[model samples]
Target: MARFVAGYFRSGRIPIRGVHLAVVLTFSLLAVTAHAEFPLPNHGESVIVGGDRAYPPYEFIDKDGKPAGYNVDLTKAIAEVMGIRVEFRFGSWSEMRTALQKKKIDILQGISYSEDRSRTLDFSPPHTIVHHAIFARRETRPVRTLEELRGKKVIVFRDGIMHERLKRMGFDRELILTPTPAEALRLLASGKYDYAVVAMLPGMYLIRELHLSNLVPVAKAVVSEQYCYGVLKGNRELLSRFSEGLAILIKTGQYKEIYNKWLGVNEPPRVTKELAIKYGAAILVPLLVILAVTVLWSRTLHKRVEARTAELAQEVAERNRALEELRRHQDKLIQADKMASLGTLVSGVAHEINNPNGLLLLDIPILKRVHDDADEIFEDRFREHGDFMLGGVPYSEMRAEIPRILQEMQDGAQRIKRIVNDLKDFARRDDAGQKELIDVNAAVQTALRLIDPTIRSSTQHFAATYAEGLPPVLGNAQRIEQVVVNLVLNACQALPGVDRGVSLATGFDREQNVVVIQVRDEGVGIAGEHLPQLMDPFFTTKRDTGGTGLGLSVSAGIVKEHGGTLRFESAPETGTTVTLSLPVPAQRG
Candidate 1:
């Protein structure tokens, strides 16, 4: 909603009008000025009262778009007691105050009674007692003494009674200000302002309504001011009538009843600024100095944090360098393990071929003797009985049978030789070696041999359970061996201090076309929470005991390379079982 105000500019200096003057000017000029204070007509019908609509629990808008509050109800009660009809007018506090001053409203409800105000307006006798006190955050003690506040920042409502009291007490006038008590207290409670002094009744209501725990009353009512009705000065008849009505209410105890209804059961401690300064100075000054010191200390700590951050960055760089070196070493180990596996396979193939090659060598001489005897017989027949031998039918059949037998032996030797050549090519780890189908079981066994010495020396015992007739797996043999070896060595480490054995088991899942290997330990089990982080590189529980934390990560990488998965399950009181599953070779079309 855009609110507009009217004021004519003259010679670059805008002239201001009083509340009533603006109303009259608007009527004559046929203009509507939002700031103008129009009369809330009495009409010998209703007693009119004006209040700050934004002020809560005194006079403000309610959910139904109607005026409501203690003051609103009190005014109606006062009118009922006086046998008069009543009407309410709502506006901002500044506008309401101006309206009251302009004789536009007969009364201003919720006015705090003060002596200085009496000179300009007639005040009804005090209707209620509301103590005034200071509030601060729980983290900050309330300002109980004037001396306690000497060097601290305090807040007060502009032109409020507290401001006057502070001035009278010779307080330094540099405190912060807000337009209303609520704003000042709000700022104080939020730590934006150090302290605020408000009427105890309003403060209590605010604290409860705002659900503010940190705000509390500390100082004694500088003066226990009363809440009274304020009438414009020179309105004696109206003023007298209000006072008489108030007296009747008071005499009937209705006023006290109303006061108690809103403010009973709240009896805050009584503390005066004089008492505060006398007993609180010794405690207050030291705390203030400590707070100052703490602030400085925190700033110094921030600088140290920056320095530590730089140190951490340097450490990260050094760690990266070390990780690169470790990666290179792991690559070398993979290559070496591959070569070792290849060498074993080649040696096995050579032994297999040696038997067939020796058999062929022994059969060759007999085969040659048969051929020579036949050739001599043929030559003699050609020289003497060639025609007769040509006529002999069974002799050609025998020669044909002998040659066929020799050819069969030669073919058998050739097949064995070809198989041996294939083994050599497969085992070669030179630059020209290509990926090929491999026996996963053989790879696993070879890896066991390579890491067996390390496992035996590091742990208590070892065992193997391998399943036969496993299908071939497609992978780099060396990489797969490295993976197995690292897994075995890690299992061995987990079994430290345990006299029990570590078991390495391998099998195949026919349906899934995958080979599964599990390495289990009867050593100490991994804690549940620590299991999740075991494969995270550089995260080790054995920092003090010599663990690099990289072995598991590397093993996991190798399994992934072979289209495989590595997983584990462990319990705190039991043992850990690490399983690796590699896919079997894909079928050829």
Candidate 2:
């Protein structure tokens, strides 16, 4: 018999090892002697066992929809040995508990031990032990203990031992009770809950059955629960019968057979120190040889890795130097772009200043003439009868002419002030990069004023249309002004002669919820081929005219940065219209 048992173990059919075989053999001998004269209970009818209908592997409806599983199989084996027939009643766990409590069912299988339940139910000796574990998304850190689940969204089966345990542990604030462990795990897999508390075997089984790839069991078991059958309190006879039958099943090896069939082979029993010592020398001899060989191999590999790491470090340094040189070249290009924009504005500014300066020069000669006339009048008054007309003209006429010349000079100075203010605003540095609610119409008007001189010199008719009650746009005011100025300057340059016209308009695009600014010019229009490349950096149709090609490109970039668009529409000899559509600020009550 000893030789046969050793052969059975070595075949790997049973996972048991070491001292466990002795325990099983001892119990088997006791079971034969104890069963010799054991009396069977006399129940008038079939024993009715109650279990959850949906729970799998333990108790559930099978493919043919009949009640089945480990608990069912165990119950049938116990009944067969006790010389009685058994029936199964499948329902919700709550219903099963109610039926068992009301004496409607003689047995309740797959129930965990609980203090409250002991008051109304008599539990049999535990048939199986289940370890409770935390189930969470695979990407989440493993929750090794119950305390780690605190402050996280935890789902548990309603009325289950896990729910009661969490409540006792003061985790009620984070607990979400579901109808079943399957439901709780489903919620956890869907990311609706952070973790689920459930038995390890059932959770793993359900995860595979449901094909929930995201859910995984944490490595550490939180608690272990003994699952047993229950009967009504004071039904000591039925509970005693169940215990004896279960003992018979275990002693006969039927319990282990059923467990292996449903849950897979049990892990090998722990090795004893005597068993370890018996095999110690066999294991240690090869391990020492491997260790010595590994040490020599590791030394060689370490030197190779050191050499490779040094090569990688040198390569990294070279790449960084190349990147630094590229950055410096890019900075030069940006500076050149800025100088080009400044050069384009300088000509328009000079023309604007010249007009005001000319008016100031004209006022100088008028002042001189007024002085000469006043001097003549005073001389004539002194020479002739003390009230003589000045240079054969009336003093009233001289006074009127003096006031008119002074008013003209004042007007000219005001015009010069406006032109200088516009230029300063355009040239102001916007380093802060702050954005605020801006009036698009106001920005359009400022651009028109700044570019007025260039427009007059390049085109005959210039018109501006402003829409009232337009919605405000959120952007950097200075940047928006720059975009408008670039567009208008481009339009002025596009005009072929003074007969061409330019128009600037501002309005709200209600459908798109944006503020629209349009600058149209009747000039030598752009060709279709050039239109696509108009916004490309360093691309321009006016290259021969000293265009640096950054105006449209830079303007388009600015518009995009402000969450807006700069689009163009043009036909040969017809006109070119550049439209800017900027998002409006969300209204606040």
Candidate 3:
């Protein structure tokens, strides 16, 4: 029967009539069904078939706790054709592969054929073709090809064929490996990832079972792989038998039935003139009746539309007025929010400056008194040396102390000046619209100086490391400083004690053509629940400590405006590292 069917297919002699095709299929099925009692191979009476239980619709544990799916059924059918008993073992993909290598499992179903695997194993003729698809949010633009996904945050099953394929295609940098496609799709739906590369059938099954409505297949399959049963390299007889059984299954239309049951089949509709005419006649009277009624209703609808149009115009005008009012309120709210944030920063700066101001105030009067007394002594000239010792100190000691006092006052004044300058730079709104080529190392230093007071107030050790020969970044210096200040301030706040340390580092990312600034803190770290919302506007973990939650959000915005990315990696008890990556302008040299 298998030989006859193969001959027919090879002859390209498909029956043109539906009845003839049905008869041929029925005979082929019967012939293959009779061969179900064929003798098993001498070496093994029962074969062990292994598959990944996580792969749905192909091989997975059903609700009945029994191994089930298309591959399971297909393997069973093939085993029956070869008159062999089958024992199914289910595990992870890697575990199953190891089992196959160890000879614990005689065959592995639902495995994609690869040249590397062919070295140690013999693959049966492919029973089915698996197509890989890119799944992403429905709102995202469709990514039809692999090239379109360059640098996209993609998720794929770890060690799966798609993962290897992506790595081979030079997308290893962007992949976020997951243990299964379901997890990958879930992450994609949650916006943690930009795309998921997975087999279409299993991906669709998971989306339906999990009810992930936000995601959809981006486009047609980006890759198609042949799935076949694998046997040990020396098991030539078993490989041959499995191939023959699979061919018989196909010839008898059993394979097609299984394929359709699991992954839906798309059949073209047969449109004959007679059938179309018959169906057309059946609806022709109703169509004419509806048309006549529609003509009459059109006149009434036109009158109603005129009235409705006038009403809609009035409603639109009211809506416009409401929208304008809303916009005014929004603007006011935004301004208020900005002012509140600015007020908080100003308060911190004021507290920092107050200490220096107080020192200057106390020392200025004492220094002036000493100077006056010394002038009087000098004018007398004939006065004894004791006269110059107004503060009970020798004249030489007084002269040295006076210079030291003036220097202290000057340093204090300079400290105040630097604070005010940093404040002025931070508060400049015009910096957002301006771009300039500035040294990133200088920016980091300035930010460190501004935040040094905050860092010193805590017992946290602070350190800065700047890489030599770093290229300048194209951005507003003040804006970059703002980002660094926010990150450092957040790091300081996260530290629970003086034993922890915060480090700021700057270097060039030569491959990506960007300047990287990293702020790492050995602090309490962020909670997992808060990581997703870490950059959300008004989302704060330090609300009790006067945190506006706008620090990270505003910082992220500033970085983005400068064509850069702000990312954070944090784990509880492991501390956090926030990285600011800003693109470097093209070098003239």
Candidate 4:
């Protein structure tokens, strides 16, 4: 290397540094020239191309009635990069082959290369190889070679290359023909023929598509052929353009994509030691140069990067805080949308429940009368026949029980009716009546009755008590009742199972000059974080089962309107207690 530099100076040539600059300039120029050279074009009319209509993963018309398949995509890609204008035509395979012979089409997109056809067509280098196979029913004895197919009734695609080959091999007399490879395979799978001859790829493709599980490739790759694009012999200009475009596709990675899209399942490119070393060195040398340049570049900008990073850190913190606030607002908005029909839902509930309770209220009285009238007959039967059964209970034991059962049913129905009436009053859009002295006990009792079914279904242990002489609260009675009903209903819903107990109690808080109603439940309670949002609109834990968090929000609104305070106390899995405090009249307090 030193001698070469010295010799260059002696010969009055450029300096070593100048030579290095020249080399870089030369490479840069070459890269620009290569980029400019595309897209290669035949500056004439569009090249008319033809292909077989039935061949798939290569060429065919798709179900959408478009000219499609692997060959179509590859041909389009080739045309794009090569700057070629092209038009496609598809028809029967034999018709296309004859079209090429008679100069009806300029090129065939793909054809299996054969020495006999080479005289009439110039073939591009093979893009793919097709191995023909003999397929038979799975139960058939495996035939390993093509020669073994003699004298057997073999199904072959009519006018296909396989048909011509079989004719030459003297099996023409025994051949059963179909128009397409798929049709041939179907015929073979129907058990009508001894075997089917088709390209291995199309055979496999069709078998899966037709779900012909009984078919198997008995003889593998009996013959393989180079699949290539073909044009009339000696049309070197058009043929050469295609050949170069195909080579360019392979050199770049576009060919790999198209190949993998269709044929990668059958054949993945095998990696060899030589290929690994060649590509590894090609990739590594450029990376090493980049690394050295990056190190030098970073050293010069280190101070600026550090300054910018500090600014970015502060900005990120501000952004994070803003994002958290925005997310909370967004959650409320989304939840509001989900609960849009809450008013309608509550009104519908009240109406539906009112109907059933009305039936109970009317029927229970008649049932009680019927039982009373039948009591004497039942007693006489007992007297005559010693303790016979009555309603699955022995008459002796049932004598006292029937009346009690009737009374309890009557009481339950009446309570349900009262509750439904209160629910309806709350559900009325314009039922905000004037404030008055509300009996906390009476309001709570009516509310509890309203949710009797929910309470019964939720917990077996439930009880309520009213203080004998608690001062009345100054509020709209219906509005106050709605709040109590919502609170108790929520308490009932919070209980995990029937075993959990819920209790309600009313008392006068003499020190605070308030009347208080408290509802408590042994339930899976609210978490500390959630307690803060209990009265926020659209914040229910039961959203999955249609809980419109608005229940508590609406309840809170009523309490606020009546000059009362709503408070919650709870811990997860321990239980929750909700307290309602309403201001008592000054004289009463």
How does each model score on TM-score?
Answer: 0.37, 0.40, 0.40, 0.39
- Tens-digit lDDT track for model 1 on 77-196? 778887777789987666777888876777887776555666676555445545666677877765555446655677876655667656655675657867766777778777795777
lDDT of 4 by residue, 1-589 (tens): 1122223322434332243232223333223323322232448768778987877767888888778877788778878887888889898887888888887788887887655677676666566667788899998877876667787899998767788877876788999988788888888888887999888877887788789999998876676555667777666556656666776777687877987788767542345445667875774576556555655555455545446556766878766565556545654554443333334444666676678678887888899899889988988888887865444223654577567667867876675565455444434453346978878888888888888998899899999988889877777888888898889888888988999999999988889988888999999999999999998765778977647566787787688777789999999999999999988877734
lDDT of 3 at 355: 76
Give every collision pair in model 4: none
Q: Which residue runs does candidate 4 get wrong by more than 4 Å?
A: 1-44, 267-589
Residue 240 in model 2: lDDT = 61
Give the range of the ten consecutive residues with the poorest summed lDDT in model 3.
Answer: 14-23
Which lDDT values do the candidates have, in the order given? Answer: 0.64, 0.70, 0.71, 0.73
Q: For residues 307-359, could you state the per-residue lDDT of candidate 2 as single tens digits?
A: 65566668797665655565456545554445445534543564666675677
| Best first by TM-score, ranked | 2, 3, 4, 1
Model 1 off-target regions past 4 Å?
1-44, 54-60, 146-151, 167-172, 265-589
TM-score of 1: 0.37
TM-score of 2: 0.40
Which of 2 and 4 is ahead in TM-score? Answer: 2
Candidate 3's displacement at residue 69, Å, is 1.0
Candidate 3's residue-wise lDDT over 184-291, tens digit each? 899998888788988888888888899999989885456656576777665655656666677677778887787778754421234454566777476456545654
